[model samples]
Target chain A: MPIDIDISHVARLARLALDDDQLELYRRQLGVILEHAARVQALDTEGVEPTGHPLGFTNAFRDDEVRPSLDREVVLAEAPEERDGYFVVPPALEGP
Target chain B: MSLADLTITEAARGLRERRFSSRELVDAVLERAAQTEAELHAYLTLDHEGARRAADQADEELASGTDRGPLHGIPIALKDNLCTSGVETTCASQILAGYHPPYDATAVRRLREAGAVPVGKTNLDEFAMGSSTENSAYGPTRNPWDPDRVPGGSSGGSAAAVAAGSALGALGSDTGGSIRQPASLCGLVGVKPTYGLVSRYGLVAFASSLDQIGPLARTVEDAIAILEAIAGHDPADATSWAGEVPDFRAELGRGVEGLRIGTVTELSGDGYEPAVSEAVASMVAELEARGARVEEVSLPTFDVALSAYYLIAPAEASANLARFDGVRYGLRVPGATTEEMMARTRAEGFGPEVIRRILLGTYALSAGYYDAFYGQAHRVRTLIARDFARAYERVDVLVSPTSPTVAFPIGERTEDPLAMYLSDICTIPSNLAGHPAISIPIGLDDAGLPIGFQVMAPALAEPLLFRVAAEVERIAGFDARPTGVAP
Candidate 1:
């Protein structure tokens, strides 16, 4: 069965800005890939539990203790923009 | 012999015998890297000053009788995705331009502790997303065996560096054949150890569950040395196995005698190149003659592995890459709002392949499609693991062609994303199963390009895996070197 995907909507969800050319290209390409991936739908996976990790190790707990971490100055130095030792970014809400 | 061409085992021996100083070995490799840079494009950032300083320290330690281990004083390359402190560790993506890591990845730190001199960071697909290094923002790494062909990638640069004698051995992360496929293409040994055997603390995650950092080397023993130096539990990575890491080097001479080797019935014949299938057949024949029992085992679930991988890996990638939303530690594109800034930054920073996968992943994990795509893929993953478990009950190890085909022409599959994805068909199953696998060069093709025979073992079977690989390495006696690149 062929699947219908809204490439633009998906790109929005992925936080990507795709131009017209890239959008068309990815639509065609991803269509083919997902079509092939449709084979997974045919497998009798009923009653088989999903595997999130190959090793199947769960709840990798450790002692909750403070450990030395990367220095603030060093970590902030790699940021694109920083002020007051914190990363700077555009506002989350629209301006008044 | 040029010191650059020595395997880690041989190089370590030379250092101990005082045949060459660490400085001399580093200089020889640095010079070779310079000679091959224009043709191979193997390295993205060469740590000349750092490598020299490390070499001098190694020499001083040796002079004072402080031995660090097998990797001490050896020069090697790292796939750029593995973080190195103070070095611009780009995952061959523009997004990470000018970004220097604050700390060394666990594997890199372990290598440093072992006294291994890191010559440089090798190129790879952006975020280790593609099968070929062509997806790198830098440039594709050419195969040393045939310059017109690609060095099979995301680990292409590391494979080429080792093959060209620019580095004795290198570390490459294998999410889905990133290490093994390239090693096959470049005529080297590549190991993708059991999933948790090596910590993922600092590896740029493609699919956290599937990714593993392993060694690509000229010889099996050299690969063992690197694997041992890097393997062990790390508290920093919670998923890291807490079990003991065995002495992999001790398993080298055990041979494959009395080993049960099963050739996966579904992995060969159809899409595989004739030479590749023949090489695997010949390897099984040699092992059988040497007293190993060979049989055919069917893992029918492997047929859907590629499809399952395409979905599951991308779904994980979409989540892992959300951390790269600009404003912190990488390139940031300006926009009116934060979300807009992220969109613009990702649009400009990522390459075509990365963008495509991100979109695919988002779609797979989207509200309605989750159960059909991502959920079903995980179920398939479960089946694939079950198949491996069942097969291991019958066989001590499994054999297959490392790749369906050899290193292809640089531009041949670039246009077809699906075609590029197909390149990793044979090597993806082991990743999905979370089993340990190794690819060793068995012979050359009719065109003189190398063919690889892969042997996969159950989880934590490194010792057994190395034993079979060593026996095959001895039996095949594949000593042919690439003469095309003038190494």
Candidate 2:
């Protein structure tokens, strides 16, 4: 069965704006890939634990020591838009 | 022979013996790069001045008897995805066109500390998402073997650079065969170390769990040297292994006598090209003749590795790539609102394959589909890892053809994403299991393109990989270079 995915809605969630062509193209392409991916569902994985990483280790803590960070000006210089020592961005809310 | 064509081992020996200066080596490599670059499109950024300055410094240090080990003065290429501080480190995506990272990736820093000359940043699939370098927003890198064929990517540019004698060696990240597949296709030795063996601190994340940085070089010894220099724990990357990394170069010459080698049943047989199958058989025969016991081991879960990889890697990528919003570094398309600006910037900046993966990833992790897709895929990952655990119980290492076919002509699979993904079938399982695997060029196929033979070992068993790969390298004697490229 083909997956019924709302491409536009998913794109919105992904913070991507898909044009009409991209939406149609991706819908078809993703359908084929997902169809192949459905093969994973054929196996009985009941009670089998999931693996998030290859080596199952966690919490690699470092000493609580302050290290030098990237220069603020150097970082902001690469930003697409920047103000005085801050990244400039469009407003979060729509204008009244 | 030209200094550009020397392997890392040969180059290091020459440097030590005073046969050639680092300046001479860097110059020859840059000149050769100038010769073949237009035809191959291997390097996205060639740091000629930086390379010369580094080489001169290495010479000066060596003159003062302040050596920094084997890589000192060796010209090495880096995949564009590995961030180089103060350099334009584009992952071949338009979004990062003007982005200059403030910090070096841990692996690159390690290489630099060892006095390795940075030749340039090689291209890759944008965000390291595609099988072929064709997914690169800049353009596809051609195979040095045949200009019409692909160099097998997302590490295509790195592979091409090494194969064309533009760089002695290179660093490439393998998410799902990005390093090994291209290495196989380009006829070089490529390694994807155990997941956490090398730090991922500077690498642009594709799938954090699967991404690993390793070497692409002309010889197994060279690959081992590069791996040794870069492998070890880094506090910046919490996922980095904190265990002692064995001296792989010291163990490389141990030979494969009496080593248990298993030929994975699922990765071979009917589906592969006859030449590729013959290469695998030849590898088995050679190893068996050398007293290595070979057997066909069944890893049934390997059958679903591709399916599981497609879902799981994309799911992880979706979350990891969320950092590319327009507010920070890279391209920003203006919009009336912040959300619209991010959306527009992404739509305009990322290439088709990157966009496709992000979309696929988003859908898989979406509310209603998470359990069926992303969650199920993780369980499948567990199955693959369990399969490897069982197989490794019986064999010291596993062997298979790195890819099903030699480098195919460019544009052949660009339109078919499934066909492109299928090329990674043999190499994906190892990535899923987070094991160390290396691809050694056994010989050239009938078409004269190089054929890669893969050897996989359990996690952190890079020493074993080097040992077996060294034996294979010795046995195969694969010395053929690209046709038109004269040393």
Candidate 3:
């Protein structure tokens, strides 16, 4: 089956910026991968439960207790932009 | 033997006996790493001074009669994906180029507690995605057996370091076949422990459910020692198994007597290189001679494992890797808007292969297509696990060639992602089933390159897996070393 990939839409969701040429490249490559993956759909999976975790464990919980945390200075040291003990990011809202 | 040549077991013994100090061992390993760095490209950052300091501390502790266990003072390498506090932990991606984790990965922390000196961080395929190390941002690690050929990856550097004697052993994470395939090509032993047997707390997330940290070593015992040290419950990771970590060393010498070893008929037939098939067959015959009941078992869904893995791994990777968006840590490409900054940072920071996978993953999990792709793959995973469950009813463990073909030339499959994905065909089933699997050097191929034979057992059955692996290792008796490497 030929796969019609909305490369731009998918890249946007993935937080990736692909130029036109690169989008064209991925359009072909991802099509091949998806075409191959499409074979799994042919197998009758009716009543077969999907396994999200191989070991079948669910809802692992621990005690709600305090523990040592990374030092604020050390954690903040890795940030590209930091001010007043907080990470600085691009504006959350555009200028009015 | 030279200090660099000592296996973890030998080095530990030497240190205990005071025959050689940890400093001598670390210096010799550093020297070997420096000499081979240009040709092998095995290490991204060698912790020369740090390793020296740790070695001195270990020596002082030993002198002061505070002996840590088997790994004390033994030099080993960590795959760059595992977090190392105060040290750079790049996943071979420019996005994480200078990111220093605030804390060591639980596995690395355990190794430190055991007194294993961190010699360096080894190279890998970016984000541990590709089969060959060609995807590494630093550069591909060359196969030590043949410098021109590729070292099967994404744990290529870890395998190469152990094979080249640069480190006594090294840890590598296997999402699909990263650890086993590379160890096979490099002629060393590699283990992908039962998923969750070792904590994934600080392993940079890549397909979290499937990714597992394990060891590559010059000998089965050495690998077991590393595994024992690293395995067990860690409250830090929710999925970490809260179970007993068995004495892997004690289980080693238990011969595979009366063991029902199954050979996957599908994996052994045509499509495999003759040398790989022959090596695996010879090992099976040897096991039979040693009283193992060898039988041929079939997993009809085996052929679709690679397809399922490509879908499932990428689907999870898409979600897991969404954390690298420029704000908190890693590379930041400033922009007018947060979305633009994320896009630009990701585009510039990640390599082509990584971007390709992200695109594939994003599309797989997108609306209107999720059921057809990701959901279907998960159903296939259930079928594959059912196949293993059925097969294990009659067989104690299963065997196959670790990789379908031996190491190819460095750039042979770089252009074709599907071709690159095929390299893990034989090793993916275990990861999907969350089983423990091991790869041991079976023998050499026609070109004198090493071939790996894989043995896989059910989850939490590493003792059985190691027992069978030890038998294969003994029968194969592969003692050949990579040429031009003095050990």
| Candidate 3 local Cα displacement, residue B209, angstroms | 0.7
lDDT of 3 by residue, B1-487 (tens): 5688878888898899999999999999999888888899999999999999999999999999998898999999999999999899999999998999999999999999999999999999999998889999988899889999988999999999988888999999999999999999999999999988999999999999899999999999999989988999999998988878766766778798899999997787767899999888888999999899999999989888888999999989989999999999999998899988999999999999989988899999999999999999999999999999999999999999999999899889999999999899999999999999999998898789999999999998888888889888888888888983433
Q: Across residues A1-96, which tens digit of lDDT does each residue of candidate 3 receive?
A: 668998989998998988999999999999998888788988888989998778998878888999989999999999999999999988777888
Off by over 4 Å in 1: none
Worst 10 residues of 1 chain B by lDDT: B478-487
Candidate 3, B-chain TM: 0.98
- For candidate 1, give the lDDT: 0.92
Candidate 1 residue-wise lDDT at B103? 92
Show pairs that collide, candidate 1.
none
Clashing pairs in 3: none
lDDT of 1 by residue, A1-96 (tens): 556778889999999988888888898889999999989999998899999768889878878899988899999999889999889999989968
Model 1 TM-score?
A: 0.99
Native-to-model Cα distance after best TM-score fit, residue B295 in candidate 2, in Å: 0.9
The deviation in Å at residue A32 for candidate 3 is 0.6
Q: In angstroms, how far off is B444's CA in candidate 1?
A: 0.8
